[model samples]
Target: MPRSFDEILDQAAVPDTVTDADLDALKQEIVRDVTATLMFGARPAPEGRYPTTLDRAEAALTALCAELIHSTDAAEHLARIADLPIDADGALHFGCLLNLAQEPDGALWWWQFAAGAGNATAAYCLYLYHLFHGELRDADHWAHEALSLDTDIHLTSPAPCRRRKLDSPPEVLREAIERLKVDEVAGAQFHHPDHRLADQIEELADAC
Candidate 1:
C-alpha cells in the first residue's frame, strides 16, 4: 500500500498548522534549513579545509530522496523531486545541488520540471535561475507563479506581497542586483542562443 504522488501533493497542500501564516513560516524554515545545510555545509571545522559538511549535506539529501521514493508512485514526482526532466531523471538529491551543478543546462532542466509540478520552492528557485541567467520573461513569469502559489497556500490573505516588503533589506537587494547582472552575463555566455530576453531580465532584476 504505497501512497500516490497526488495523495502526497494533496496532503502537502493542506496547512498542518492552525493558520496559513504559520504554514508558510514552516515551509520557509524548512527551505532555509535545507538550503543552509546543503549550500554552506556544516560549520566549525578545521581552518584549512572542510568537506565533511558537504558530505553530510549529501547524506541528508539522499535521505530526502529515499523518503520521496518510498512515499510516492508517480514517476513525475520522482523526477521533480530529483530536479530533472520528465524523462532525464538526473541524480540530484538536494535543491542546492542545482547551484553546484557543472552544467546549467542540467540544472535548468530539473528546475523547470519541479516548477511545473507545483513545488513552490522549486518555482522560487526557477525564478532565481531566470533572474541570474538574464531571462527576464521567464523570471517574471516564474516569480508571478511562485507568488500565486504562495497566495493559494495561504487562502485567506495575500502573503507574498507582505513577505516581499518585509524581507527587502538593503544588503539583500544589492546582492539580488549583483546576481541579476551575473545571471545575465552567464546566460549570454552559456545560453547565447536564448539570450534575446537578457536585457528584459536585467531590467526586472534591477527593479527587484
Candidate 2:
C-alpha cells in the first residue's frame, strides 16, 4: 500500500539523534545549499533517484496531494490550491516547491510573503537561505525573529499530522546557530567579526 503522506514523512523525519554531520550530509544530498532540506515537502525522497530531489518537485507534490485532497493527483491539487486564498502554509510550501524546481527567486518571494504574515518557519527558511549565501548578519536577524515567534511550527504540507511532526523551530535553529555563535570565541570564521553586527542588522531589518 502507498503510505499516506504523514506515514511517509514519519519515516523520513530527522530523529533527535541526528547529528550535525548527519544534517550536513543530508543537506548536501537533498538539495543545494541555497535552500533547507528540513523545510516542508523536502523529505521522503523516492526510492532510487540518484540526487534524491524530486524532479520539479513532482513526487513531493504527489505525496502532499494524497493528504491534501485525499487523492494523489498533482495537477488536480495544484489547480485547487491555486484557486483558494493562500495562507502561511500555502506560501511556505509554494516557495519550497519553487526552490525545488530551481526557481529560487520565486521561492524567496513567496517565503517573504509568508514571513511577513508572522510565519516562524518562513523566517527560519530565510535564515537558512541567508546563511547558505554567507549573509550571516541577515541570518542572525531571521534566527532571532523566528525564536520570538510561535514555537510550535509545522511544514506547509501533508496537513501537519502528529505522525509527522517537525522538530520545534527553536530546537533546530538553536542547534544551527550554536556552532556559528561567535560570542564565546574571539574569532569565528563564518560569523561576522563585529559583535555589534546583530544590532545593526536589527535596525536594518526594521526599515525593510
Candidate achieving the largest lDDT: 2
Q: Write the per-residue lDDT of candidate 2 for residues 1-208, one digit (tens) a residue.
A: 7789999999898878978999998886545423434443344346565433323233333233223223233233233334542566556554544443334465567677678888887676777676556354676687788778768653335322222222332332233233333332323222211222222222322221
Tally clashes: model 1. Answer: 3
Q: Provide the lowest-lDDT 10-residue window in model 2.
A: 188-197
Q: Rate the local accuracy (lDDT) of all candidates.
A: 0.41, 0.47
The root-mean-square deviation over C-alpha atoms between each candidate and the true structure, in angstroms, is 22.1, 21.2
User: What is the per-residue lDDT of model 1 for residues 1-208, given as tens digits with 9 covering 90 to 100?
Assistant: 9999999899889665578888898897566445544543534244257533333333333233333323323233333433433422222222223233223454465556556766555565566555444344675687689787664421111211211222332443234233422333334321111122222223322333
Over 4 Å off, model 1: 1-95, 151-208
Error of model 1, residue 159, in angstroms: 20
